[model samples]
Target: MNSRAIKILRELLASDQPITSDYLAHILDVTSRTVRDDIKALNHSLHMHGAKIKSTRGTGYELLINDDQNFRHYLNQSLNHVSQEQALLDSPDARIRYLVKRFLLAERYLKLDDLCDEMHISKSTIQSDLRSVKKMLEKHDIYLDKKPNYGLKAIGNEVKLRFAMSEYIFDRSETGSKTIWRDQLSTIADADKEQLDKVWSVIINQIKENHISLADIAINNLYIHIAIAYKRIKSGHQVSLINQEFDEITKQKEYRVAHHIVRAAEEIFMVKFPPEEIAYIAIHLLGTKMVSQTNMSEAELENIMEKQIQIMTTKILDALEAKMHLGIRHDKELLIGLGLHLKPAINRYKYGMNVRNPMLQDIKLNYPLAFEAGIIAGIVLEQEMDVSIDENEIGYIALHIGAAIERKKMQSSPMCCYIVCASGLGSAHLIKYKLKAVFGSRIEVMGTTEYYKLKQIPFDKTDFIVSSVPINEDLPVPVIDVNAILSDKDIAKIEAFVEEDIDHVFEYIQEDLLFLNKDLQTQDEVLAFLVDQISKTTKLPDDYLKRIYEREEIAPTAYGNLIAIPHPITAQTNDTFLTICTLKKPIDWADKRVQFVCLLNVEKDSKEDLQHMYEMLGKMVDNPSLIQQLVQCKNYRDFINTLLAQN
Candidate 1:
């Protein structure tokens, strides 16, 4: 079957309910007729495989497997290999990774025509994929050197070349290609799986015996580099480092540990590691070695980490508090954690090492407020220490800040609540005394009042109203209806609300700011559309878009689930607002496909606690089915209702 037909089958298999042809066409960027024809052909193919396309009139298509055994056998024998082969070209993100690995491992320049022939894609398709390939390479300071006859070759510093190679090849989650990197590596050179395993064992033995501390990712990185070094050294390739750098790295304790690791590898591979090669391994060790000085007094923590790192930590927190008043400035745990993290980070920056953060996306989606605070902290860290930090490092810093935020929340004042009663003053006193007895200091009772005087009640200091009688009229604060004596269910409801304090989703979404199913096809187009729509009602800074782009540079705001939450690096408006846009089709935002774009901006010079709003957006970032529902929304009421239902 053709790739499009296979894609239709795949989509149908993934969805439990039937999907309309128009929706499939929109996803595939084809006409409804083409989707129908593909489904027809797909049904034909599935007939012999014990599966058929069950089409529902006025609904859509669903894949029904009549015989699971027969279908599984057919899939294993037929479609499995075809899908793997077709996925490279059928998916742009996958194709870009394929092209990157091809160039990274190529010994000589490659031709465009040859790549097209290999992938069975048109010249235009490969050319379009090349732009993304070039952008990905440029992130690691590598450039594609093009020739008239010879198509393209990646040119960059030798160290960066190997670093990019490790990331693209060894990083299975991000860069797993059609043929595994190990299989390709065996073809490209003398490097084999067995030899790499031996190198890994040697490195682990050395690190354990020498009393050195390194995270698992760090250890894997060192292993990959050393194995690559072995292959290059065997091929008569040597690394070049500045004399000053070579001298400084050789003096560290990590350099001695690297020596043992490299010496063991040299004996097994029957190759010798040059001084520069040993130093390269040492650089990896220096960059990734974690300092464990947690749960100590401030003086003890500061004493363990360098004085310079301690000073940098103080500045980072001070600056973070200055820009965003998160109330974590005096958090000693944060101070100690930042001090410990920044020390190794300094080594990473000095030697230009990039650490991979697997949790970066989850961190951004879950702790958005903390992640934004981490951005401010990153900027402060760069200026305070005169070093550059990437998103991966920023993610690590966010974890510490997130912990501090949690601590602040726990230690902050209790939820102030007001009581309303229709029975009498005695009933209000019984309710208040019961709440205090049950909840203790967790909730503070801000006096009680009768229901008739509720019109004159001020709610500025109250979090919510606990009323024994039902109040039909909407007030500024939420009212929780309860029995006069406050039943256990009522207490549980209040307990849950107090723990989360999540506001309704409607507070963040507005009818005027919501744009559904716009025809924008690119990241820039979507952002510009949202900015234009928002600017109609609210005045925005002249460089508002520029600030958003700057945040994107730090890390793409696309948090998967076809959602991208774009916001400025710093607050841009006088009030907090979110402008949302859902596209007709998914567009490429960095590496992920995004259909729902929420442009977020916090208020400037304001003291609003925005954790609840950020948490709401975070939940949206993590939910795919919810995003689908939001994307399918045709009107503001439906969209708002869908969000409220989910909320």
Candidate 2:
């Protein structure tokens, strides 16, 4: 019924054995009923496409196509038809060539034997494939080289590689088949389709007017434009291009220059331009007929466009403000685009340029929606000016913005925490720590204030009052008073009051799992690797590692085998990083000597990571021969290779 459902179905089809409905539901993150509905929907869709998706009574759905090879061939042919219709020269051979080229691009040098092994093909077949690929490269005026001793390599222009990849991956219809868009759109309800059609119409008009070539644009942007058009229509606004009459002037040099400028604009603004606007901009800057030979230098274009766009942006903003009667709000999106355009000019006129505007700082301090947003903004700004902003600086910015937003929001319907301390700052500090730990960094703690202070201090803003100290009066807000320190009884009460809230916060902030560097030697080596990875990934204080080691002293991870697994079941770690190592010599572990050791450093709530770790460990322990191979490994890379090579 949906893209996610289709993905689940595909996964089921690819699986070796039948999958249960419950398993499908869990994997899809949907209800079992929803999964059943999805199966029915999938069956209907398959039938419409002249295929069938069969489902067993107790088992899951499977594609019932008799010939896998024929299906693949048909799919490829359909893709080729779409490509030709779109004026894209894509064929089955081209698709294979592109895949090979992409694989080659990832490596500096590749051995023919290793590649043949990787592809699971014969030497002659690989040789033929390579020859075809070499010709394709040469057609683009690129060259592939092979030395007598060395391996196959692509050399020459870097632009050629980038351009080739961009065109092949982004424009090819075969590639589009791999995406969710086709499945999702096909299954849309009739009512939704009508709504979508209206949105698409506006987008089509915009594209036509702007002369935007779909060939050059990414699918992501195309999807975004359709979404924006839908939103605009829903809001009862005319979905029209801002600059509709812009003429297309596509010279190779100018077009490339313009594309770069527009790309910079999009990055700075964090917005995708309408297809038409992108096309118009490309033509205007490049020329009418963009020849491959004609290319503008980045420096020349950046210098000129910087001054021009600044004036243009100012005028555009002024016109919008005047026409809309809504005051222009200087935000990160506006400043970034403005800064991008004016960066070169600012660099040239460093001393004389007016930098007195408070807008930049104001935007930085106020507008970002997330911690990542501030980090990205700072990175973009630093890159524009050829400067560096360290992680600490970015972190500081995020904190400032976070604190400011928290403070502003707290101004209305503020949260109150009553510190229940019998005496001293130590007890108060402990209570404060526990409260913040459970609630968050944002909870306001009114420490050891008298009952009079609770009455005098704005109680209207107080959401919850927690106190361990003696209270004479009944508080206006929910009073959570405890007799002693955070005992089991006290913790139970606190948890009961805030279980839902805590769960919601944890859902948002929880990390998935951190994979190991896939490098380590012995079980001891893996233990050491885990320690190092935990330090970097978590950014925990130095003393935290010492605490963890001290805890380990009480119970060594060696569980009576040649294998050892060391871990702490606490939320102290940010993510789970597995450090697997094979000892050159078997180490005495518990009762059994172990050649392999895996150290799992997981967050307390990370059940997924723990389960995965458990499964991997179980698999390794079940096979003694695999352990022997791992022990023979000289380095971490070799050890990982040996581990993966196992059946």
Candidate 3:
């Protein structure tokens, strides 16, 4: 089977219901006949692996596993193989990536004609690809320096060049990833992959022996940086520090660790690192890992955190509370986490280094509210410390803020539930025990009762019903159906029920704020229209427009799938609401195109969870069908109905 078949199998595995071939074709952008053919081949392969795609007439296809163990065993090996067989230079993204690696690794200037011939593309095609390549390199302050006849060579600061190479080249070349946040690097070369693994082992041993608590990503980052340094040094290139403060870094604990690491690496690779190189590596350690012992208490860690970081963290949380009122001001975890993260972040800012966040887009898309809070935190840090914080640093801050939001959610009163099973007492009790084990104190199972006797249980006290059998009768509260013996999906459904609140999202929507399709051609025009439309009926801050623009300067609010959510850099609106504008034509955002623009305003000093509102908007971000409906809606009533239908 091809990649499309693998995609079909993946989709089937994710959904419980039978999926129509047309629906699969629509999502995969293939013909229905092609989908059928792929499904046929996919089903044939599945049968031998203890699973088969069951075709239901008039409905579509579903996956049925005959033996879970055998299927999982086969899946592990099959997916790994499929990953290795991916076409590296087939897609546009892959092509641009190939060109970048070519430029970064080139010793002499590259000839445009040679690249065109090598990639088997016309001159115009390679030139177009180079445009994107140039844009990407420009992000790291690297630009293509054109030679009269020799073609082009990438020129930038050596440190920046290494940063770009690690981010774009070595970071993604390997498929193996140990964590979900981002892929970690252990080796840069496949032929010499084993040689690099020895170095990785050596680094790990030093970290453990020193009682250092470096995250997976940090270790991986160090791996890439060290490998790049070795390569650069071997080529007679060393990072030059011009007017950088190395005296302060030398006295730091990480500097000693970096010294030990390089001393060990010298024996393994037969390469001697200069003192400046050691300082650079130490800078990385400070940025990635904060030295901590296993026996250290939270109080000890707090005491160790710099006084300046403590003040900055306090201001960050205070700003968040005053503006968004996210209800995380008192979160102790957030307090400690922010302080620890910021101390190293100060070093990164001082060094003028670009922090790479692979999860920035996902963070922006999924956690817009927290990302907004991150923007405010960055602004506060800038004001207090006089340092600029970019989107990548804001993303790391968002992770901490997002965690605080979740922790607050978990600490809230547990939702009540009554376990109802068709079988009279015994089965209900069995399910009750399971729920208790799974949820702990997060959910309070009020009581267990038969479906027929569910009325005896007080409905007023219970928030919802978790039934072993389907409940046909409508009740005052919600009903979540699960199997007598819970499966992972059943647990997920209940978790979603507890964590999400999407029903009341329209409370923030105002008919006067909704603008259907207008002739806005630019981002500025769209923002002006939304602000003007809302300002006519309501009083807004004099600098409301300025705030939104300031936020844009920090990061482009345009997330992909034809949508952009613009808001103030810091919350200043009197009430939480959304002023929306949909453009008749797409406008060019900084990085992506935008048509649907949402001006998100949060109430000042208000205590409300923006998760549900953000979740609704997040779902719409990548939904092609939903966005089309939003774009084509003609009036206020129709537009609202479309959003209502989304529920």
Best by lDDT: 1
**Stretches of model 1 off by over 4 angstroms after superposition:** 1-84, 174-189, 192-194, 385-388, 408-508
Lowest lDDT block of 10, candidate 1: 170-179
Q: Point out the worst 10-residue segment of candidate 2 by lDDT.
A: 349-358
The local distance difference test score of model 3 is: 0.78
Pairs clashing within candidate 3:
none
lDDT, candidates in the order shown: 0.81, 0.46, 0.78
Summarize candidate 1's per-residue lDDT along 1-647 as a digit string, tens digits: 65577667666765667778866775676789989888888788889989999998977788899999998777654543455467775677768888998898787899999998888889999999998899889988999998998778999887888888887865343223423544545555476667766776788788888878988667766766777787777767788999999999989999999888888888878888888998999999888887765889987875678778877888888878776778899998888888888878888888777788878877986787788888888888778767777888899999999999999878889989899998988999998988888889989988899888887777888899999988988899989888987788988778767766444545667889989999997998988888888888899899999999999998888876678888998887988878889988888888767889899878887787666777788778765557878999999989877876776
Return the lDDT, model 1, position 238.
83
Top-down lDDT ranking? 1, 3, 2
Top model number, TM-score: 1
TM-score of 3: 0.71
Candidate 2, residues 1-647: lDDT per residue as tens digits?
Answer: 34454455455544455555655553444577987887787666556554666777755566676666665655444433333212212133543554455543444567778766665556787777676677656644466677777786776443234333333333323224433343344232112444444444544454455454342323233433333323323333332223432332232343444455445444433446554445443432222111121133434434545554545444534432332222222333343333343333232222111111113322322332223333443444444456544332334344434443344344433256666455666777777787677667456676555444555655666566667766776667676777546777776666556432222222222232223234444444555555676565467556555554543443344432245655542335565455555544454432234555565554544434132233355545444345445655665456555655653
Q: Which should have the higher TM-score, number 2 or number 3? A: 3
